[model samples]
Target: MSKQVIALAYDGRNAPSVTAKGDDALAEAILAIAREHEVPIYENAELVRLLARLELGDAIPEALYRSIAEVIAFAWYLKGKAPVGFGQRDDGDAPLLLSGPER
Candidate 1:
């Protein structure tokens, strides 16, 4: 209910996992850690509310595939690639979460 923050982790093969989440002060800590780590931050209150219900390490719900896919793709585009070490292979041509390059 309080200002919430949810963090997800993804590899190019599997569904994204809910790696971290929190409310209120914990939410602030999550955001701070993300900033300190240079992690991409996505704001979608609707989606956050939905995802926040998920437990840590739980892959996103199938119903959220399309929405989450869009978010990942957008994040990839914004970053020019998935953030380093986010399951990015050494191959150097890895697309965002198994998705082909964004044209």
Candidate 2:
């Protein structure tokens, strides 16, 4: 099977959308751009298979929300970012720091 890759974009307010998808050479290009930009990469063949069914700019189906959410959360954790209202306080922008799994 050709190596497949799917990219998703989420705005915290809406469902994640399929921003890109490709196989083989196209996949390598997409992944290279992501690496150059320091975007975290998550690998799951099954998830990619499911997401590949979506067209570009299409929001993910509700059934995949939890699975996609987990991937997004993992990416956020890898980037050291927390979603708004996540352990925030009234004082300022200080967010609660949680330990991540060992790499």
Model 2 scores a TM of 0.82
On TM-score, the candidate that comes out on top is 2
> Which candidate comes out best when scored by lDDT?
2
Model 2 lDDT, residue 83, Cα: 80
Over 4 Å off in model 1, which ranges?
A: 82-103
TM-score of each: 0.76, 0.82
Residue range with the least summed lDDT across 10 consecutive positions in model 2: 94-103
Candidate 2 on 2-103: residue-level lDDT in tens? Answer: 667887778777888888778877887787887887767888877787787889889889999998878877877776677877863232222111111122
- lDDT score of model 1? 0.69
Clashing pairs in 1: none
With candidate 2 superimposed using the best TM-score fit, by how many Å does residue 76's alpha carbon deviate from the native?
0.5
lDDT of each: 0.69, 0.70
Evaluate model 1: give its TM-score.
Answer: 0.76
